[model samples]
Target chain A: MSSFPPFTRLAASLPDHVPFVGPEAIERERGTSFAARIGANESGFGPSPRVIEAMQASAGDMWKYCDPENYDLRSAIADQLGLDVEMVVVGEGVDGLLNLAVRMFAEPGEAVVTSLGAYPTFNFHVTGFGAKLVTVPYRDYREDLVALAEAANANNARIVYLANPDNPMGTWCEADAVEKFLAEINPHTLVILDEAYCELAPASAIPAIAPLRPNIIRMRSFSKAYGLAGIRCGYAFGPAELIRPFERVRTHYGVNRMAQVAALAAFADQAYLSEVVGLVAAGRERITQIAEENGLKALPSATNFVAVDCGADGVFAQKVLDNLIAQGIFVRKPVARGLDKFIRVSVGLDHELDLLAEALPKALATARI
Target chain B: MSSFPPFTRLAASLPDHVPFVGPEAIERERGTSFAARIGANESGFGPSPRVIEAMQASAGDMWKYCDPENYDLRSAIADQLGLDVEMVVVGEGVDGLLNLAVRMFAEPGEAVVTSLGAYPTFNFHVTGFGAKLVTVPYRDYREDLVALAEAANANNARIVYLANPDNPMGTWCEADAVEKFLAEINPHTLVILDEAYCELAPASAIPAIAPLRPNIIRMRSFSKAYGLAGIRCGYAFGPAELIRPFERVRTHYGVNRMAQVAALAAFADQAYLSEVVGLVAAGRERITQIAEENGLKALPSATNFVAVDCGADGVFAQKVLDNLIAQGIFVRKPVARGLDKFIRVSVGLDHELDLLAEALPKALATARI
Candidate 1:
């Protein structure tokens, strides 16, 4: 390799491979487009019409930079959540916020805890920052709050991550269990409660905003239920003092102007959010039914996606996912050993789901071969 | 102060103040809006009609996550620059790209070089990364390139930053001088040439990209003459080896979907860009005239904004800025010592300039008090 300016020892050590390969890359590789865009856990139901109108109306005003403080959006979010404005901070998305959170809390070589098969972006950040990861294995396909708390305390970790209504497995812990987990974890360990899928999840799976604690930061997003993933907007709410430190390291103008408008409109359109939540619920049911008809066991999901156990092991699930892709359906599976028996599929439009339903049986048969 | 989570020692030591406060903040604080939104060096003329139409048309598709590879946008940028796609990396803006650059090159306590009174966000990143920043003051209102190179060499700096057609001062060094600086700088140092205002600059001010080098990253933005600041899109091109590391740390989906669409359309509509450049040149002339009309000396500008010397010191220039803001004409000034004698005003719509013209005399008179 040609010699160049030296990267930080931490940065130099990180692997080049990203946590997720986007569907677009797969499409380019296959040299054909997938008829069903049912991967990446994005809502195909799309944003509310009001949000679309808001974005369209403001499209011409792209000459101005976004409000660095995100004042208006933060106020609106605080008002909706009944929290102080100082407690809310918005960023490019939950992904951006996670990067900041890790940079803030976890020093290089310090321990950071998360479930083994949780959201990989968090792990990517931890590794990027040179933090030692202490991964607790998932218990019964749900994030085991008890094991995570123990690992965090035992390792003296600086940050502990838990994604409720989690990705890949689409399983969630109840609100009471979450509250107990918050109470039990080491207070010095910042628990990043990634509730990106909160709006799509059952109300019982979400904790109340009242009696907020310093150790936990609750992340919410427009990407899931509001269906504004492409706009790249998410917010994290916690105690005021904790939230203040994000300003130290965040890219001040990272959130674009259109995202602010789209998110504000989406937040205001609760009627549309409710309707999408209903749609996601129905879609999940349909996906589960499809999995059953194809002789696979779909895990009970509190998210917009379902993880269907492929009746074999990691190789079998991978083969099934590959065959689905080959059949013009974009779907994914967990890569970690214990969770690899499952293939995760996101809810899409009805026609897309119909395409999935048509493709599943043939894909399974091919995978068996 | 109450103690919560333990931030990294570097993060904890950094200040909480943001680099720039948005004008909306002033609007909120004063309970009034500025009639002229020309403070932040944003293009009041806005993005092209085609870009707007593209963004508006894609408003409903906010449900899909952005292509993490940024393939199409990077390809577009690379083709325009006569470079391979591997040499290009798209980001949220130059601000976001700057952060990545700092993270990639500067380890804690390592040295970085830049002109004092240049872009504060770059300095913010340097500090955030725990890098030792060695500042070289501008000479004759332009970045002292010789001094910057010397400082980088003396300190064995990991990075050297120079913004051609620079911010705040609206000044630039010629292409030959820049090329000389590039040649003289230590090979181990990564030079970041921020050419954000290159489009509005005289053609001779920007160096040709034909002679590509490993140690330099040329940062460009859609935020300047392209008039898409609000979309928060920018790209950096450099040797592929240098560019590849950015993927290791960048928030893959950090650039939103709307930004990609707007920027692609903006890049394609070069005719609109040419028109905007002409308008910016005309606006710069008009602003210079306005400054002269008010008995202030305006620096000749190659960028969209002019730095008008208030014929006084830093305090007097601040007074002019305050009075303009008080009169609901949003304008800003340099906070650095030598350059702080001038108040920077961005080119705006005709009526906004008229409003600035109306406010300048009274503000100057009140400051004389």
Candidate 2:
């Protein structure tokens, strides 16, 4: 109602559409659970036994408020990354950090550059902050870094985002190309390299942490390789000067106490992480083989998920995705223009994949008709 | 360093001091944990057993990201508060929600009104957003509503914040005055009535939820009486139209899975909540007795904590606080110019209050110049 409290002008003009819907809601709507839980890029392996133990052990301490400074977790990440603790700031997740970064860099109406089909959450934050988005179409199913850099330079964009071993497309460029892209970034633009999947990707595909660029912030999450998404935790590393501004606006106590504890314990159990990564790799291969057998081409993936081209138009891909959903398989499709011809699937447990194997043939046959 | 981030002019000018220093940091520095953990106003009474059980049971779900919609929690809160689900928005905490509310309503350099020594976190968010803070001094130790509304009208302020059974001072106004203040509010202005301590206060002090004003948003937390502080959850309820804009800027998935489970369980266990409230009221009496015996004036409190007038200035209050800390007691003081004469303390367990009683006289003697 116009009689309602006045929202600031920027907030008044913002759209009401959310970026993505959760599978839980879909299940509630469909009145049935998906047999194959391979959507949303979450780890089927779950958190480490040590992490669960730590969380349970600390359950009684839920009476106390969390450390607002996030001191210990930042120190742990800083030590692991070969950087000072000041170079790090952790939040609810990469999603929360992305929102803060957008607000800090791009005020209202400034252009921000990213791939057309990169993480929709990043675009959501850009739009949430009233920033103008300038998209560079994916080239070869990978983020077109050269074009993105050019767009940033031409538009004098305030921020540029890229996700290596990216979502929906499941492709990555090697570290050398990433380094070169970093070098070519416009002086006025800050680059946010979201490496949420880096731990699961091939080592060579990740840029080395040593030569940390001042204008670049690389965000990581315990949600993927470490498997604690429900805890709502993630971290970003960058120049101290760049990172410090986040304190000005971030929800200081945004990260829950269990999250800080779970993430810390998850990080401590490197053995569990390695084991999960190995299992994910094997699952990805199994998925690729299944795709090949079905006469569809799964993209060469360096991350925990595979994006399979339906070998047709976006309409065909949507039909296939719908068939999969109808067949009780949970999977997601890319919605960005030109990137819409593929469906992305995360690596689930063995039995879950078995369900996928059992259901995909029928879903594909139905789509074909 | 400046080369790393060209922060927006507003961000660059923000002061670096954090809103609150955590007690754990104090414990770590002091090499001993505090006997009385009352400074943060946390419910030393702890959360309900059912809440703890629910959290433990849901610990394994850490791998799956929490439902971004917080569908179940929102519905439960809405049903309890007699509002539509769409009118209730969950956030990390009242602090987190305040940040969003201020941003959605207040513009840079515009005035936002609050009592002089109310919640520092609210002030933190206001200043963080570049709004000029207009303060009304407390009258006879209570938040002066008349002064606050007058200041709001004079400054043409877009937002005003009031905390019932207010923080730092542990005082409140009657429901009639609060209703009058809301009715008299300018249509262009939004009033944030923070009822975080409402559950522990007298029922007559809080207005009925059905009488919704378009410009009013009331915040509630499970932190105080429910004792789920470490879980970091709170909610804001307002008219549907006013509440919808929060979707534009909020960190949707910020509240963790455990928080949702715990909060639901806490809400369901009304018997446990009533028991905790009884204990808190008794503990407040105990704290008052100790203060009165020591010749300090303990203010009448509706909240879980008591604010004791230390019979001296802020520096002397700091001495009393420091001496208590040195003696392994954790307590805090309000730092506003007029309100600095009182030190705030939460009602801890009997043994903890016993420790406070034993230590106070020696600390008082030493605190004197």
Candidate 3:
């Protein structure tokens, strides 16, 4: 073999596959912009006005690097969660944090578990790190917590990832069920409880943030509910002992400076967050109503997006998604066997949803043919 | 083995040491702010007005995620460099890219070579990835290319890191010298040529962008010259084949949306960059004059900072640094044995430099006592 800049054995073995292609790439390919952009579960209601103002004010200060320690933002997050500042670690986003978490916990060739069609970014990190991914499929459109614990024990998995108020399908396990699931996981297996959508989730769907556990890392993001996805800020909290190790492997200044400022401002303006939460709830209902009008069944969701079953198979659901995309209404669907029958739509601005409502019937008619 | 959240063997063995402590942390501890903030080599000149405007304009759009592909920014960088977009990869920063590059090339226990007392963050990533770092001492306050090349050959290093217009010292190697160094390296050993400060260096220091080599990855940043360090945007370009691997491991949306917008504007406003570069050169001269006035020798610099020799040992230089800090002026110094006698001071505004000038004599007097 040619020895021109040899990559590591594992890196060489990994395929070049991105988890999700951004809608921008599709727009570039199609030479047309999506008329209604609700595909990726981003909040079209946008960030709190205070956040925008804070970001604008800090624009000139971009010449200085961010506080590598992420002190203030982490402190605020800690205060809200009723945890010590040392128990929280901030990252570029949940995506960036997952990469660090997987690297820390999973040695190459070690087993890691997640639902088959859960977050693709987690799967990407596991494979990128050369860990064996043992996936347990969803049961009844929810992450099968019982199966995940069993798989973790069976494979002696190093890490198990579960997204509460999960993505692709917005079903969630209640607090008590999650508490029982945690009890069943082996102590050696680190649980990555990603709650990126938690702020948009029902209060009943979330467990109390206190009484932090060593084997569990609960991650939350400004991306989903706070509507700061473009800024790329997220954080993971756990026991201080578990959190301290992140310093060993993190890109210290990976979190952007403006992100810290925006997140701090976003966090402080609880009124705006409450408003966005209310708006998101209303949008979800609107989407469900639209789905019903089109003779599809929308799954019960605690997330910012709703998964509407197409009343058909995976292929038919895919055709519906394609037809929606062609009609300039961007949407996505789960790719796994059982979940693929559903088309996922994010809560959007009223105008965007109106466009979605206008296009759904035509998309369905075309998809049926 | 109590078995509570077991980390990888490498992570378990790692110490919880942050590479560099932020100035904010120091202020929090001291309960006082630095009057002159020039410690971390960030541009005191700030980013271009157009860049700031771009960032402010895009603040409200933070609800949308950054394009994971980094298409427009990469295209702009490619256009500026006269290279195909395929040959370049954008990252959070040179620090972030270093983490990816090290993980891509170095397996556990593999040797990675760098000059001793170079960029600490690079060393952090090297060790963080379980790579053994082989170091060569700088000769005459400059990174010793001959020693580094020999070290790589002797140790069979998987990767060798070299920062042109080197950090902590602000010294640079000429293009011809670097070309010779690259020619001597084994093709199997990848070279991470960091030119983060290249925009501030003389044209003779930068190698031509064309005639890309598979084994050499040239990394540059918007942080130093464009004055957008807080935005955390950097790029690396090399042979397209080598650049392709970065996609396999990078956090798809790690680069922030505001960062991309800010960097694009910064790159476009070359006139403003030229103006900042001129101001930086003037500031460097002023700093050199301040060192001379204080009866200390200032090392020649190609970057934005001057390393002032205290005319004593590392201990004496450290005293001067501590006294300067205590006197409300922020600065840093090299810690490696041979270079530790010099206190590194970044170019600041005239008023800040005056504060440095006024404090330097008092600091030296206290050190001498």
Candidate 4:
């Protein structure tokens, strides 16, 4: 145990495991680029032309530091949400906000609750802060909110994480159910409602942005339907007191100037966002159709991606995913026990879906063999 | 105490004081933008044309999430520094990296040593992580290496932060003095060697890249000399063992995609960097000359900023700063006791510098009255 340059006990306990293996890393490993990159749930529909223009226009302003207050961006987001500006705080992304939220609420060795296969990034933050993770298994491939509420109470967890219109599964709960789940959790247990995929979800799936709760921080991102994943901007809104503490802990200039400019541009283009959503809905249907054509069942999705049941087990789904990668159509699958039979694929361009459609049967055949 | 939705004891103890109020916030309060944004020590020279071109070229690719590995950018930095890729880790900025470093090394209630009023952002992080900050006052205008080393040893500090070509003062120690300071610190204490302004410093001021010490993590940034502050990209390099822990705690996709592209292009365009460095040097001389004309003494700077002493107290210096802001020339002053008499001005464009020169005498007169 060489303790030279000693790390904190928590840091030493952490394994050097990255939460997500980026597609670029996979491409490097393969010594070639993926022909259709649909692995990471990023919007394959690029940002609005206006966002690209805004980014290009602001390219020369990179010498200036970001406005640490994030006034304009927060004001826009708050105005849209029908909330006061003080209720909102912007961060690098939903991932970045989660890191701050966990640090604020979860003390070392205290429990934090989430679904078994919810966002690994949240779990990463919780563990990074030395908090114990208490997981509740999904029910019918959806986050079992009731079970999560129960687990938080059972463990006296400091934080509860739930991603609506969830990732890796593409299933969702309606506003009423979420509201009930919110009411069931203890006020001491802070709830992080990560709505990263909210734009792609049906309106019924999202709660009205009113009656702000003291314990709940609702997160939103431009990375999904707005098609600016690379910009890494997101915001969390809650009670004013809850939002104020973030100022005490956050990296003041963490949100880059480009992100502020691009997100503002993206937020203003509601027409472009709606257009992307429609396209994403259409892409989701095409993916479902592709799954049916390959004699597999695609789960219903309110997200930009569809989860197709590969009709076997975790091993089979992994084999199918690997074969898709082998064929240069990057795809991923759930790793949780009950949900592992599904392969998740994002809605890409028509040509990319064509690549997926062309490669799926071959991938399935190889998995069968 | 109204502890519902509890924050950690450490978080609750922190004041909502932002480390540095951004120039934009000041402008907002004044209900107008600054004529010359020379504060924050950001390069007003702007990023290279090639970097801007790279950003514009990659605008449409904002739909794709950044490569979490930061592979290509890390490889480029490692190659230039004559170090292994594993030794280098790209972060959102040096600010973001400092957050990680403090978290990794300093446990709650443990001492972390640095000079008083060195970099408030580092102090912000130290307190944010619940670490006990033990400060040694600056000797003269420079960061007193002897006092810092003594404090680290006496306190058994977990980490010691030193910025060569120190911020707010622009004073630096030679490589030999720094090497001696490094040798004096205990092996168990981590040293965050921030060389953010290293590109502007003379060659003799920077220590050699090789013979990497186990206890030191050297930080460098594109935010300063490369003029990419808005992009929020920087890297830290050290022994592989120390660098590996960052992956365990960092926001993997925090550095936006445009940052990666722009920083790579910026790093590749060395001619533009040298040109900017030359321009900055000339600007420093002009600022010094202006100080002389105004009958003020400007500190010799190894960075892009010069600190002009007001020859009075902090109150008089602050009044001069306020008057300069009133005239629409943004600048800052060190808030530490000994350093507070001086106002820090960054090297801006010729036109911006003209504004500073035009305003300085008026500002001094106002302060005197």
Candidate 5:
């Protein structure tokens, strides 16, 4: 190799592969647009009309950089969560916040615990920071809390991640079980409760904001039920001590003003959020029905997406995903070992679901073992 | 000290202070908004009508996450600069990109060089990554390029930052001088050439984009002449080898889709850009004339903002700033040693400038020592 500027051995060891391929890239490669655009679990229903109006109304306000403190949005989020503003720190998205939390807590070479195939973004961050990942396998398609707690203790991990109503698998452990996990995990481990999908999940999957536990930081996203994923806004809530460290390294002005406006307006429209949750539930049921018609089993989900077992190996699931993509649909499959047998599908608009319905049988037949 | 959770010794020593307090925070504290919001070098003229229309046109597209690859925007920007897409990387703002650059090149305790009172955000990033900052003094109110190159070699610095037509001082070096500085700096030292004010400056102030310059990364922003600071979009152009490492740690979806639409539209309209640049040049002249009417020497500037020597010490300059603030005319002043005698004012709309013109004499009298 030609002599190159040195990277920290940690950085050099890491490959340039990203955790997820964005939808636009897929379109570019396929030389076609996705007809149903529901793969990322974004709310195709869109943000509240009031939020769109707010953003359009403030287009001229683009001259000013967003408030780094995110004072107004932080206050709005704090009031809604019934916590002090000091307990919440808003970020670019839940993804950005996860990176910050991992950097703050996990030292180089220390193990970070999480359920296998939970949220790969968290694992990406851990690996990016050169922290070792200790993954516990899922049981019953849900995060196996007891096993994760033991792994944290055995590894003396610096952090443990759990996403209630998890992505990829679309499974969950209820609030009581989460509390049990918190109590059982190594006290030294900082539990990052990623609830990015919590708003769409059954309320039972979320806990009352946990401020007493200094080791727990819970993250939530406006991208889910709020329908503002493109704007990149999310916040994390925790004890002041754990939350305050984000100030040290965060891109203070990373979240833009439009995101602030959209999120604030989204928060104000509780009626709209209630409607979105109901629609997501309906979409999930509709997708499950589509899976049944295709002779596959749809896993019971507490999330906005359902994971349908392809009734064969990862290769078969891959074929199903490829067929969908070739047919101009954009759903994805989990690639982690056991989870690879299922293809994940996000709830979409009626037309999009119809497209899915129209194509699933064809895609399934294409993927026959 | 009371016992606390352990932070790395270096992190524990870092202070909690931010590089700058925002104008919004000032308004909240003062219980009134600024009549002339011109301190931060933002385009008070606002984004192009076409850009605003584009954002409004796509207001409904906020449901999806931004393309992680930033495909279209990168392609547009790279095409504009006559470079390959691989040579360009978009970030939240130059501030966010600076953080990533420092993280990649300079390990903790490594030396980074820059002018004494250049862009403090760059210094903030350097300090953030635990890099030692070796600052060369600004001579003649402009960056002393010879001294900067000397210091870079002296310290064997990994990065050297220079903001032409610099912030706080508002001065520039011609293209030939910049090219000379680049040649003098060691190949191992990555020079971050921040041309944030490039669009507003004389063309001679910026050199031709040199894609082969392995030692330099030029930072530009939509936040300036494009009038989209609230959008949090900026890009760095450099050799592919240096830019490739950014992918290792960057938040893939950090840029927003609204920003992409707005920038693409902004770039598509060069006639509007020319009109805005003309207005900026006019505004700078008006600001300079206003400062001279009060008997303060307005430094010759190639940027959107002008630095007026308050004709006294740091305290007097600070008084002028506070007096402007008290009169609801928001302005900023330098707090560093040599530059503390100057107050910086940005170009704003006619009425906003009139507000500043009306406040200047009174604020000056109040600051009289």
Candidate 6:
């Protein structure tokens, strides 16, 4: 074998794998397109027309590099949130920001706390950084905030990650309860509240933006409700002191110029965002109805997706997911132990949801066999 | 004072600063736009029409996240270079890939070798990762390849970074010399060959893609000759084993979807690239003549930008740069000791170059005072 460069012990120790298999990969592997693209939790309603127009107008100006500071976008985000621009740092995506957070807050061998079945990308980063993961299992389909706080104090962890209106399960904890959890946690640990799906969530589930705390970094994204996931834009707001450290580690020009332009336009069109939220809510009801017809329980959700229980074990849920993929219906399921009995489906356009409604019965029937 | 979350030892020790102040920041501070946007080395000619068309067409499809694997773009790159798909990885930009490389290769307190004045972004990442930077001085305004190789071996450095068609000086070492340097280096040390401006350089300066080395990662970008700097897309290719590990640490969806489509279209249009090359060459000669007209010497460049010696000192060059900026002409200068006596100007649109020609003598006369 040819000799190779030596990777750091930490990097070499991590598994060489992608955290999630993107829908494009599955399509390439199957040699057929998914009839319903209700997978991956992306908005199928697309970005606002104004956002697309802005992107198209700036297409010829792609020769210039993006602003390294992300000043304009940061200012806009801060303006909307009633915070100083220094309190916000825009990144390529929330995933990118999370990667930086792990490096900034957690050293090698330090502990990071999270719920067991939360966003895998956060776990991937903690592992890549050689940080020890202390996971708390979900309590009754929601993140066990009290257990997570206890674990953080017990382990003296440097960072704790929580996603409100959580992924895969689409369950959420009330904002007031989350605030209580925050108060109960050790002040030395940084809390990363990934609010990517916040816009799709109910107003009560989102905390008021005021009184910024140094120990908390709240992340928001254009990906979920703004419908600009493909553009790769997200922002994190925290105390100015904490946000300043991001300069030391972030890829300065990682957020593309087109992303900045599109995000700014999307942020301006709150009307479009509200319309999409209503559409998503109606689509979730349709999915719930569809699950009822199949005699399965659809979990109550606050985000864009609904998780439908397969009424059996993890094995049965896996079979159902495989059968759905085989039938050219793209959907994902939570893999964590208690959560594996459910399949998660994002709200897509009407035709896409109709196709999912058509495919679920056949998929469930096949799994029963 | 409010208590803050505990940051890592490395993160705490680093200075919170931007490596380079972007022109947008300058514009914001000065309250005026640059009349001639020839600084930062972005192409004034812009990307091809087809690439723009592709970006505009995909603007509405921003709801889907990018492929984590970057499969199609990697396949096209591998096919063009006659390498296997596994040998390539696409990133947000060369800057993003450099961030990953530092984390993967250099552990805290380990050494990384580079020229005293190379890409500042690379230096930023090295410091951010808590790696010691071992610097070698430039020889004759070009990177001293022999000294760099020696430093890597002596320090037992994990990474040695060299930009072919070196930045700031716009000088290059021939392919044969680079190969010799590569052969003499420690096999265990990784060599990062940043070929960002390779397309503008002579073919003799670029080594053949065959005979892949396990220790070398060669990076290229659509940011330069392809005129897509704002899109944030670049790729690194090397042996498959080394490439695989990037997946472990990379932010999977960091590269945006429009970037993929625009870059693929950019890659397909080699004719536009050649035309840009011809334009850049003519522009370089014009800059050289302008330098001579102002009683200075313009260094021969293999890259798109020309570095003109001020025929005085670093102070004179700084004054000239300041004067240009005062007149709303954006230009940059090298900050390292020997290279600091020169001012660098990127080729701009014809009218912008004409503005440069009109502004030079006045700026020089004011600097002489």
Best by DockQ: 1
TM-score of chain B of 4: 0.99
Cα displacement (Å) at residue B197, model 3: 0.6
Better by lDDT, candidate 6 or 5? 6
Tell me the lDDT of candidate 6.
Answer: 0.92
Off by over 4 Å in 3: B1-3
List the DockQ of the predictions in order.
0.85, 0.73, 0.78, 0.81, 0.62, 0.79
How well is each residue in B158-247 modelled by candidate 4, as lDDT tens digits?
A: 999999989989999999999999999999999999999999999999999989999999999999999999899999999999998789
Query: Worst ten-residue run, lDDT, model 3 chain A?
Result: A1-10
- The C-alpha local distance difference test score for the whole of candidate 2 amounts to 0.88
Off by over 4 Å in 4: none
For model 3, how does the per-residue alpha-carbon lDDT over A1-369 read when each residue is reduced to its tens digit? 235788999888998767669999999999999999999999999999989999999998999889989999999999988889999999999999999999989988989999998899899999999899999989999999999999999999999998998998999999999999998998889999999999888888898886887799999999999999999999999998888888999988999899999999999999999999999999999999999998889998898999999999999989989999998999998999999999999999999999999999998899889
Tens-place lDDT digits, model 5, residues B221-325: 999888999999999988888887788888888888888888788878888889999998899899999988989899998888889998989988898889999
DockQ of 6: 0.79
Residue pairs that clash (backbone atoms under 3 angstroms), model 5: none
lDDT of 1 at B352: 95
Estimated TM-score per prediction? 0.99, 0.98, 0.99, 0.99, 0.98, 0.99
Error of 2 at B150 (Å): 1.0
- Clashing pairs for model 2 are none
Cα deviation of B240, candidate 3, in Å: 0.7
Off by over 4 Å in 2: B1-4
* TM-score of model 4's chain A: 0.99
lDDT of 1 by residue, B233-340 (tens): 999999999998899999999999889988999999999999999999899989999989988889988888999999989998899889989999998888998999
The DockQ of predicted model 2 stands at 0.73
